[model samples]
Every structure is written in structure tokens, then in C-alpha cells.
Target: MAKEIPQILKGFRDYLPQEQLARKKIMQKISEVFERFGFAPMDTPALEYYELLGGKYGEEGEQLMYKFEDQGGRKVAMRYDLTVPMARFVASYPELPKPFKRYQMAPVWRADKPQKGRYREFMQCDVDIIGSDSIIADAEVIATFDAAFKSLEIGEVKVKFNDRKLVDQVLTKLNIVKKDIGNFMRTLDKLDKIGEEKVVESLVEQGFDRNILKKYSQLMEKSSKGYVNQMTQLLSGLGVEQMEFDKYLMRGLVYYTGIVFEFVLVAKPEFGSVCGGGRYDDLLEKTTGVKMPAVGGSIGLDRLFAAIQEMDVVAPQTAAEVIVFNLDENLTADYLNMTTNLRNAGIDAEVVYEPSKLDKQFKYAQAKNMQVAVIFGPDEASARKVTLKNLREKEQRTVDLANLVAEVKSMLW
Candidate 1:
């Protein structure tokens, strides 16, 4: 029989211990920030009925979704993002507290062309407020964005903000019909990627009057300048000043009805926005025929991890702080006892399963990034002593079994 090749899908890759550990730490810190703002945690299923998600995301988003027919012959789609699933969740639970606030960190699948900092399957950390229309709610979500990045210590970032209504107003002034507004907003969204000249050229090639598009460009510039609103003021009072209005920030989601925003690491602007979200006042209504105002922000965990890696943010490679070596077959029980004691004392400890040579065990401890190693051989066991080796500092000391926990704690600190 031929052996199957060990290869991952083209747009997918695996994360080894070091990368996964760092990513986990980043997610934990972001979760902490989310909770600080009084947001509770929630999640939805990976698959939703295809109709539940259809006509929600823009045309491009719909094309990027992984949709198929299940064995039951029901059309289902892998969740493209947390927000749409969240809408479905909220509509399903109408009894949930009004102004429902939730934070979800989970993997979402997209059949997108993978590139640097972009993946087909990636984690998204989302915080949303349902049933609230106050500008303060928008400010709260933006402030959470500020606090999250600060908590990660990922250097400085600037949150660029805009409103879908602003886009509507501009297009209205340009005499663009309501039916054409979505396409126009999508075209304007390309300004950052294709500069003003190319965007105008594309619009003109699409048969939009050159003079109207020229005016549209001027209106966007004029609108962005000196833009101040209740949302900005609320954010200011909340001490979230690392943000500005970006008229071109037309979030591609068709559900957005109001404010939209995104944050980018100021030092890594080339990496693009690591987080983005906005008010989608009409999504719930569309999903369940119940109108509820909602706002949310989502951190692209993969992009965030990539940015931090590029910045060399250090994270622990292992959760284990100490490794208890199995130095003697006869002392295995003793090593197990010590490991349990360390753990019970609120220390993360691990014990090798079998006896091994001292050098080999020490190398294993170092490879696992253990800060301390406990060595209890036949001799030490006889003396009721355990040798504590500081793997990081390369120092060793012998202590009584009674002092084993205390000595290891001191070494770790």
C-alpha cells in the first residue's frame, strides 16, 4: 500500500509550540481587555444555514465564504466572520439582556487567497454591543480597541474611523442613486489600495461622469477634515485619543449602517489594519425580522500575531515553569510526589515519565524552556533532599524535600 503524503492544504499551515504559545498569550491579553469593558464571552457554531449568511456580506464576501451541501442535503456555510453569526445568535435569543455585550474569540473560515498576514482559517476576537444606538456605545467599542492593543504592548497604534452615513451623504451629494451607492462605496474603499487617481479613473471607466467623481473626491476630502461628532467627543472623554476620521474607510460589509472604524499599528502601517468593525443597525432586522441596533469591533488575530512577531514581542515558549527529572527508576514515585506538591502550591510543574541520564534530562528541560529543574536521584532520595537546578542561570543547590517547593519558587522568581 502506498503511504499518504503529509501535506497541509495550500491556504492552511500549522503553528508549532513557540508560535502557538505566543498567539495564545496574545488572545488571553485581548480577552482580558474585553472583559474589562464589561463584555461577556459567547460563541456560535462554525456552520450556519447558507440562507442565514447569504445577502448579508457584500458580493466579494459572499464569494469568499465556504458553502456546501451537507449530508442532510441542507445548504450550510462555514462562518465567514464572527459578526454575522453573532447577529443570528442574538436574534435566536430575544430574551437576552437588552444592550447585550459579548466577546468571542474563535476560528472563522474564508476561501480567500492567502498572503502574508492573511490566512484561509484564522482566529477573530470580536466584541459587540447589541440593542444600543448611543454614540457612547460606539465609543465604548472603540475604547476597547484602544485598551486591547495597549494591553498587548504592541507599540503604538492609530484607530481610523468613519461613518457609513458619511459615505451615503457624499454619494447623495454626488447624485449617485441609492442602488449604485454600494458599488460606489466599494470603489471608494479602494482609494487606499489604488490611490485617488486610479479610483477616479475606474469610476469614470464605469460610466460615472468624470466631473461628478471629481466632485466626489473633493467632498470626501472636505468631509474628513475637521470632522467632529458626538462619537469622537465620547471617545475623547473616555481617554481614547489614538484615533482619527478616515473618509475613505468604507467598511466593505453591506450591513454597516452607521459608524465604521479600524486600527493599525503606527509603526507597521504597511501591515494594514489589525482590527475593524462598525455599527450594523440593520443586520438583526434582516436576519430575524427584529430590529436591533448593534456595534462591534474584531481583531484579526492572525494579522495581529504577525505584526507582533515582526516587532519581536517576546512570549513564553512553554507554560511549564519547572521540570522534575526522573533521575532514578526507584525515585519515580518521589519525583511524582514533588511534582504534585509544586502544582498544588500554584506552580506549573512537569515530571518526566521515565528515568533518564542527567545530561539528557537537563537538555530536555532546557528545550522545553523550563526555568527550573528538580533532580532527585537515589542518593538525594536517601538523604531526603532534592537538587534544584536553575536552568536559566545555570546554578544548582540541594534542599531538603520539605524546602523543595519554597526553593523552586525562589529560583523561578
Candidate 2:
């Protein structure tokens, strides 16, 4: 017979109930932050036409997307990010309110090599503001991200910002054609990953003149705003200025024209930006053929989770507040009724369903981390009373049924 199949995939693992509880708490906190900032929730289909998602993400992103022919023989792919799909959403539904602030939390698929903190399929917590290009939007996005990380109880995170126009001015001065800009920016994007020396080598390998490397290297080294202006001004020598700080940002797509930004964890520098976004002025024209400027950002939930785990900042597991101990077989129904009443009162109570000895029952309650255990013994049930046991304090009280609500309320309150 064939060997038994494993329960999980290579890059994916099953989330146990305790882990799921933690995840829900984390998500709830994030959602609250987003809502407080006036961002509402929205969702779109996970699958999109292959062509729809193709040119939005850059060369590397397109490669990682999971694409295949559907049953109807239509080429489709799981969305790789919320931004691209939102672009399509705006284009398809032109009537959407202007400057819409939306938050989307969903899973996306990618076919990529999995590592310690990287996975092929992962979730993204995205917040986007469409139909505006004001610097205020850009600044607010960064500020909101700052608040979000704090709300998550994660450590300090920095938002690295740059302009696409600067890169463009440098390339234009070098006499590179418009067609080569994509290739050039793609190479520049790897500067963080490959380092200056390797990136220069790759640029040369990509058929760029070696002499052009010196000026770029000098500019890249002097990336500070002051140095950048000096290089562009001195190098251009043109009567009119070009490649202002706002212009030379890293443009991943044609839609993004200004103010690209990313969020990085202070503790894990090499893990890459866990959340990033930028302004896109031309995405509106894709469908409506009308220019509408927009800005947005995405949180890499998977990467953030791993980094937080490494930093030992995960939420503790505590599901049940009170467990109804199971000692007498006949009193099981009584315990169930007690737990049910507790539940109706908005208390987290669970009836221990299994038959066990008295000591074992108490041990089970303790093991489950229950703070309190309600006992419905025959005597207590017959007398129309309940025994409330506070295991942590090693105390017990027999409360009359008339005061049951008040008794439980006092402890819970």
C-alpha cells in the first residue's frame, strides 16, 4: 500500500485551535486600528483573469504568481496582492466614491521558494486610499502604519521613502531610452538585496555602459536629499532642473508615479520590507480612461507574524475562562446547564464532556488553564445552589440559585 499522506503542504501548515485564537486576536486588533482611521473593509474575488494581473506587478512579481487554466479553459490566476485587484476594481466600478479608504485582509498565492519567513501562499493586510495624490495621503499612510505596528505590540518600524522621478532623471541624463527604464529600475530595485557592487555589475551585464556606472554609483552613495539635488543639478547642466527628489523614486509599475514607501522592522533588517505601497496616478485610466491619482500600502502579514514570533511577542493562549468540572457521571447534564447559563451571560465556560475521576477532573481543569471551575454536585443541585470554586485562590462558595447571576456577575465583573 502507498504511504500515508502528510496533513500539510510544503510551505503551508495547519493552524491549531490555540494558534488560531491568537491569530484572530491579532487580526481583530489590526482591524480595529484600520477602522479607527476611517478605513472600511472590502473584498474581491481571489481569482482574476491572468491578463488583468499581468502588467500591474513587475517582472519578478508576475513570475511568482500562481496561474493556470480553469475548468472553462480560461486563463486565471490567484491574486498576488490587494492593490492590483483594487486597481481592477476601481476601473471596473468607476462609480466608487472618490478617495475611497479601504482595508482588505485576504490570502494570495505565489509560486516561490519558501524560506524561514517566506511562504508560497500567504495573507496580506492592505489599506489603500484611491483617487488622490496629495502628499498628505502619503504621510498619513506612513503614520497609520506606525500606529498599526504599535497596536500590534510590535517593535519600532521605519518607513523608507523615495521618489521615482529621481531615478528617471538620472536615466534620462544617461541617454537611456524610455523602453529601457523598466529594465533599469528593475535592476535598481535589487540594490537593497544585491548591494551596490553586485548591482553595478548586473547593470553592466544588462548592456549598460561601464562608464555610466561611476556617476550612478556616486549618486547612489550620496542618496541623501542634499547630495541628490547637487548631483542632479551639477550633472544635468541644463537650464531647467530635472529629476527632483520627488521624481526619482523606484517605480515598480507605470501606474506609480511618485512617493513610493516601505515599512521595515528594526530588529530584522535582512527580512525585507514587511509592508509597502506608493502613489499611482495613472491606474484610473486603465479602465475609465480618466486620470485619477491614488496612494496605498500593504502589510505582509506572514512576514510580520514570523518576525514577531522570533522576537517572542506572540499572544498567550487562554481560551476558556471557566471549565465545568466532570466528577460525577449523573451530574454531567447539570454541569452542561450551568455552563450554558454562563454562556448566555457572555462568559466563556465549557463543560468537561468526558467521564473521569474527581482528581483527574480537577487536574484537567487546571491543565486547561481555567481560572474558575463550577461544581454542580447532587447536593448542590438538590438544594438549588451552585458551588463556585476559584482554583487559583483555593476558595469555594455555595451560592443560592436566587443570587447565581449576581454571584457570577461579581466574579466576572
Candidate 3:
């Protein structure tokens, strides 16, 4: 047998203290923003039924799910995403009020081939609302997404918007789709990655006609409101168009019905959509026979953390404010008393390690980043006084025992 070794599986990670601290700070700020928008926090189990996992996430997502059969032959799978599980929750218990709003922060699993900024096990921050069919729901989701990105101080993000119904109308007009929606959609979704010429070639391979291609070529070229206005003038219907420029916004038929959108960072335009979601009017129908409308968005928390770090949006620095150096080892109780007092006074403090030489102890104190050192040596012990030294400023002061806590507080604060 080969030599035994210990290691985490591929596509998994171990976050050290500092790394976790940075990620937590980012999550905290995101939570505050979500709360301000009236989204209440909620949670669910990591394990759920295999039935609950099926036919919800997109085909690609289904392929990446971590599924298994348990000892009793019960089929189960780790939750793949928050949105589908949320849909199940609504159906399982329908007595909840309408327009349900909630935010979930949890880990999701995928068996994806991992690469830079992509992982098999990662966290997602999701916000969703149910039971509303108004356009304001669309507007509110867009506005909230904009606000969340803006609050995070991320780079300029343009949310490309579209409606699947509109695209279906266009495809039907072109006579390109009939029971081959998946392949056609997969081709369209690659429009961002592979250019238009190749997509046309692929469509031609599928036996789409020259006249149909030519007509839609003109349509796509009109990637602006001006073309939208022409479509409106030619047809009899109402639609919207604003700032329609070069946008790679087609994720092709992904369960979205009306008002599909994607959030992409301008810096690394090739990293693909950083966040994406759309309106799904028939989510809970799997759980409940009745159709309930819904809209939501997800922040690829792990990917965003890595990408933002590359863009130099640094996480906040979090460290202990003070360390209490231990001098006069016999006065250990006194040090503990002072440590507690400092904590009560709203200061982060910890006592330095001990039973070492005085010089070594000082070095250890410096290593632990103690700002102020208090000495209760024998001389001060006999005189009922304490010596406090400001390690940062190299200043020393002697104060009577009664005022030791107050004096230390005044100096540190």
C-alpha cells in the first residue's frame, strides 16, 4: 500500500483564521444591506430528498449535484442551491403569508471540475420573494440587486435584461425551434463566449435557412432601443427598451419567463456573469399544484470574494485590540482580574504566555501585539502601586493601586 496521507478532497478548501475573518466581514456588510431591504434571515437543512432536488435546478446544475443512496436505500442529495429548496418550503407549508421575503446564507455542493474562482463546495447568499406577479416585483428585484452591488463598492456592473417570452416570439418567427429548445438554448447561451459567426454556423448545421438567419442577423444587430422601436412599430404590442447597446445577456431558456437579467462586472468581462436570476412564475407548482409567481437573485459568494480581492476591494482588518503582558508571574491572579476589567470596559485584551525569562516574555508580548504592559513587580507590590508602560509610545507611568484600572483605561482609550 502507498504511504498514508491526509488531505481534503479536490474542489474543497480550508479557510484559515485571517481568511475567514475577511470573508465574514464581507458577509456581514451584505447581511446589513439585505436586512435594510426588509429581508428576514432564514435557514434550512443541508440534506434534502432527491425528489426535491430533481427537475428544479437547470440541466447543467442537475449534472453537478452530489447525490447518494443511504444505508436504508433512501435516496438523498445535498442541496444544490437555496432557491429550489425555498420553493419546496413554500409548498410544504402554504399557510405562510403572501409576498414572502427571506435571505439565506448557506453552503451548496456541486461536483464541478474546479478551477480558479470556481469550487465544488462553496457558499451562496440568496434573497427571494414569492406570490407577486406585478412588474414592480421585477423592478424591485433589479433595484435591490443594484443597491447590493453599489453598497459593496464593487466596480461598474451593467445588468443585462430580457424576457424569454420575447426571445421565444423571435425564435418562433424565425421557425428555428421545435422540440429542440435545449440545443438551441445551449447555443444561444454560448453567444457571450463564442462569437455570433460561430453561432450562425452552428444554427446552419442544424438546417436553419438563410433567409431566417439573415432576418434575425439584422434583428440582433439592432441591439439597441432603436431596433426595439422598429419592432414595436412593425408589430402591435407594448414593450420596453432602454440603453440597449452591445450586451451578452442571453442565457437562453433557463426556466425564466419574464424579465430575465444578469449582473456582470466590467473589469473582467470574460469571467462570465457574476450573478444571474430571472422571473419564474411556476416554481412552487412542483410543490403545490397551483402556480405561484417568484423572482430572486444569488451572489456567488466564493467567486465574488476571490474576484473582488483581485480587483483590490480589500476586506476590513480585524484583530485583537490589545494583549496583556504577564510580568511578576506570582501576580497571575492580578493579571486575570485586570484582563476581565479591560474586557468589561469594552476592550479586546488577552494575557501573554508565561514561566519564561522576563526578556523572552517581553518579546512574546510584542509578538502578540500587546499595546500596553502592566507590571506588578515586588517593589510596586510593597508600595501599593502599579507600573503601566505604553508599548507603542515607549512611555511609562506609575499610579496608586486604587486607580490602576481607571488609569489603564484612560491611557489606552
Top candidate (lDDT): 1
Q: lDDT tens string, model 2, 1-413? A: 99998677778756676667777787888888888888889999999998888766767787888899999999999988787788777777778888888889998887878887788888898888888776667666656666677788777676666766556566677788998878877777777777778878988898888766677656654555764454344324422211234222374655677667777788887777788887777766763466678888888887887788788888555588788877678877777777788889888888878767778878877766677777777787789888888877888888996676568677656
* Clashing residue pairs, backbone N/CA/C < 3 A, model 3: none
Q: What is the C-alpha lDDT profile of model 3 across 1-413, one tens digit per residue?
A: 89888989999988765568778877888888788877888888898889888767668878888999988898999988888888888877789788988888899999999987889998988888888887666656655666677778876776666666565666676676567665676776678778878878887797666454467556555444553454333222222222133333556435676667777777866666667777888767764566899988788888887788788886544355455556667878877887788788787777765645667766765655566777776788789888888877889899997787788778778
Task: Arrange candidates, best TM-score first.
Answer: 1, 2, 3
Worst 10 residues of 1 by lDDT: 224-233
Candidate 1 C-alpha lDDT tens digits along 176-234: 89787887788888888889889889888877887765787688777755455666778
Global local distance difference test of model 1: 0.87
Off by over 4 Å in 1: 1-4, 211-214, 221-229
* Residue 382 miss distance in model 2 (angstroms): 5.8
| TM values, all candidates | 0.95, 0.84, 0.81
Report lDDT per candidate: 0.87, 0.74, 0.72
Report the alpha-carbon TM-score of model 1 versus the true structure.
Answer: 0.95
Regions of model 2 farther than 4 Å from truth:
1-3, 209-214, 217-255, 287-290, 358-369, 379-413
Candidate 3 lDDT for residue 358:
62
User: Against the correct fold, how does model 3 do in TM-score?
Assistant: 0.81
Q: Sum up the clashes in candidate 3.
A: 0
Global CA lDDT computed for model 2: 0.74
